[model samples]
Target: MDYNEDTATDAVLASFEETTDPRLRAFLRLLVPHLHDLVFEFRPTLAEWEYAIEFLTRIGQKCDDTRQEFVLLSDVLGVSMLTETINGQQEGTESTVLGPFHMVASPQRKNGESIDLLGGARPCVIDATVLSTDGKPLVDAEVDVWQCTEDGFYDVQQPGIQPPGNGRGLFRTGEGGRFWFRTVVPSHYPIPQDGPVGELLKATGRHPYRPAHVHFIAKAEGHRALTTHLFVAGSPYIDSDAVFAVRKSLLTDFTESRDEDLARQYGVTVPFVLATPRIVIEPEEGDGSG
Candidate 1:
């Protein structure tokens, strides 16, 4: 039982063969070989291994109630987007990363209400509909939405300056599965670059900017929930999103509208951007709506 590069992985994997959970056993069986293969392929100096351990340690230390360094790590590495792609609904709006900012609960608000607490920024009205894949409107669907401010910082990112839920809302679809809300057009901003992930990005000469987008998590009683984004079309970094979460279908135009009547309807001043995004959910199994 001499430990060699090829046998090392097998020995470690065999140790997990007795795991009770089949999924866990399978994952370990697969992960161990690949990880060992990586180690075997690129043998590192003791100092390098120590530095790697310290890097991962710092990544864990950087996480908190409000910030998730692991999610950021997955995002910057494109793992989050890949996971979403693999598990996403087949016939709905394309899924994207549920960025770290969704750590808090969204405050419930009425339809057409404004999520923006600090006013005076340019307004954008989001008129959205939640429907089944068959085009049937889903009544009373919950839509949780959040975005950064016009200054490109989320409420959580600037706790002292931005009130809680400054750019977040939980609304339900009204009749015809419609929901609308008012908020400032979010600005393209860099991801938090104050931690290990930031250091990694800098070491790799990669930028940390993501395109302007609004996140949505739509759920209905009998339908599969959808977590996705409405990316601002033509926004900076749209084509080069640092997280690699952009899908062409999710890119939407926030058209400029100066209609006073439309402004009054949404309770916003004139010259606001109007966005209309439709979300489609699939019926869950055994829901009897299929």
Candidate 2:
């Protein structure tokens, strides 16, 4: 077979025609033509192709145990959100990107405990509940939460400054499917912009900021695990999120309260903020009965 632009795609796809996995074979068959079409249309010079390769190489090299450059790339390109939207749960809380900062494990803490290790910032209480779509409480549910510091950096992002688990906690829902935690209000922050993804954003005139939000991964024995964000209402970039992840349903108000009694209940001082969000979980497919 002659290897010309017109024949190249079919020839390459033919090589993968024998892929054992049905899904992989179908994906390759669908992907090759479009990829080849782009290559043919762009007609990059050898130097430009080399640069593209180098760019991807740097993206891989920038990844570490704490940072995921590929996910960051996918996020900035809106690919992550698109994929999530396509395969997300139909009922319950709306889903969003998990972001690149969830690389570390959350330390388990008791209900009503505080995840704010540094303290000294304006505190906020998160009173959350996990329930089934039918409003039944999901007992023993695990809710993993994490967020950036008041200064807009995760503990992993500022190693020496922020203590480990400074803004992270894993709590189990108690009676009535309730869990609460104390932490400082999170500030809007930029995604890591010191690597290849940053360079791409700069070149494209795109910002790297995400709005203030706390990430949650809620799971139970029979329910489908949910990964979502609770965006602070009125936060910067809510409308023009850098990663296009802001969903109106997930925007939650952080109300100010000077009630000393409520503050003491959550172990925070007065003049604090309160965020009360309810999470609904859907049962996994084939949840019961064989």
Candidate 3:
């Protein structure tokens, strides 16, 4: 077979005939032709291809234990959210991208405890509940929560300033499948923009802002886990999340309240911000992951 434009794709596909793994062979079989067609259609110059290779190289080079530039690159390109959307559950809460910041394990804490290690002028309390699709409360459900600070910086983003496990907690749902926590109201802020992903965003004239929201991962026995967000109502970037993870059903209002009784019940001061969000998960079907 001649290695001309007419035969290049077939030649390359033939070379992978012994790939052993059927899935890999099938994947490459589909990928090679489309990639070759794209190259021929676009006709990128030598220098342009070199630049693209170099850009991907830098994205890999920028990754470390705490930072994930490749995930950020996928996220900015909408691939991450698209993947989550594909495997999304048919019932219960809609899944969203597990953003790069969820790289570490949350420290265990009691219900109604404050995740905010640092004190703030305004405190917000979140009362959360986990339930099955049939409306039964899931007691002892593992509810993991994490969020950025009031200024929109995560604990990992600020190592020296914020202590480890700041703004993160692992809680077990108590009676009525409820878990509560107090923290400072996080501000809507831009995603980290200091890597190859940032360069791509700038080149495309796209903003890197995400809406203010608290991340939640709910898990219980005999049910599929749910990964979603409690998006603050009327947040700055609610309609234009940089990562395209906003769901209207997930929008929760952080209502300001002055009820002394409720405040005393939750061990908080008067005139606090309160957000109540419920997470529902579908029961595990045949061969479903727990």
Candidate 4:
């Protein structure tokens, strides 16, 4: 085993032969060959490799309890959405990436209650239903929702300005699998651009903005839970989502209405905007494989 430039890959790979975990061994075995090819193809200098490793190290070091740097790195690299797309459910509704903002537990709230604890003026009503693909209602389903403010900042992103849980809520479906809530219409905003991921975006001439949307995580007893977003129509970055999460089926309209009766029912002012969406959950087969 004479290790040289040509044998560097093999030497590094053989070092992992002593790994006990079968999965880890298999992963390393596959990763080493491809990584070696990449290095050989690029022929990057030692300084270049060192710089890349340091960049990755900094990405990890930037993470903490509230922020996830690795996820941000994956997002900027489009790896998160690609992974989600690969494991996506075909027969079920389309799935999207669970963005980094969903790090905290959403507080349980009554139906039609406003998640905007700050009580700023960007109010709107969201009405949705949990239904099977066969058009049957899924009673007792749980819909967990969170979103950014009208000004494009999440509650966690602005802990001091916004109270905890200012823009998050968990709601249980009532009879007929219906649920509703009140919240400010979130505006489009850029993802965090202060880390290595941001630098990568800048180097590649890519913008870090995400379109306006309300996050939804819906679940029922016999059906697989769905993680998706109802993206606002005509929002910026809808065509160029930094994470590639926008799906045409998930685009929803925030329609304006002057119906006083409907407003009274949802406890909102007349002539308010409403977003009516029907979330279709697919039933899980035996053992829930994949």
What would the TM-scores of all predictions be?
0.97, 0.97, 0.95, 0.93
Residue pairs with clashing backbones, model 3: none
lDDT tens per residue, model 1, 1-290: 88886578878988888899989988898899888878878998899999999999999999999999999999999999999999898787878889889999999999988999999468889999999989999889999999999989999999899999999999999999999998999999999999999999999999999999999999998788889999999999998899999999999989999999999988888889999989999889777754
- lDDT for 277 (candidate 1): 88
Cα displacement (angstroms), candidate 1, residue 266, comes to 1.3
Off by over 4 Å in 2: 288-290
- Scored by CA lDDT, what does every candidate get? 0.92, 0.91, 0.91, 0.88
* Cα RMSD, model 1: 1.2
TM-score of 1: 0.97
* Candidate 3 off by > 4 Å: 287-290
Question: Candidate 1 at 184: error in angstroms?
Answer: 0.3
Clashes of each: 0, 0, 0, 0
Question: What is candidate 3's local distance difference test score?
Answer: 0.91
Q: What is the lDDT of residue 178 in candidate 2?
A: 96
Better of 3 and 4 by lDDT: 3
TM-score for candidate 4, residues paired by index: 0.93
**How close is each model in CA RMSD to the real structure?**
1.2, 1.5, 1.9, 2.0
* 10 residues in a row with least lDDT, candidate 4: 281-290
lDDT of 2: 0.91
In candidate 2, the residue pairs with backbone N, CA or C atoms under 3 Å apart (3 or more residues apart, or in different chains) clash, namely none
Worst ten-residue run, lDDT, model 1?
281-290
Question: Could you arrange the candidates by TM-score from highest to lowest?
Answer: 1, 2, 3, 4
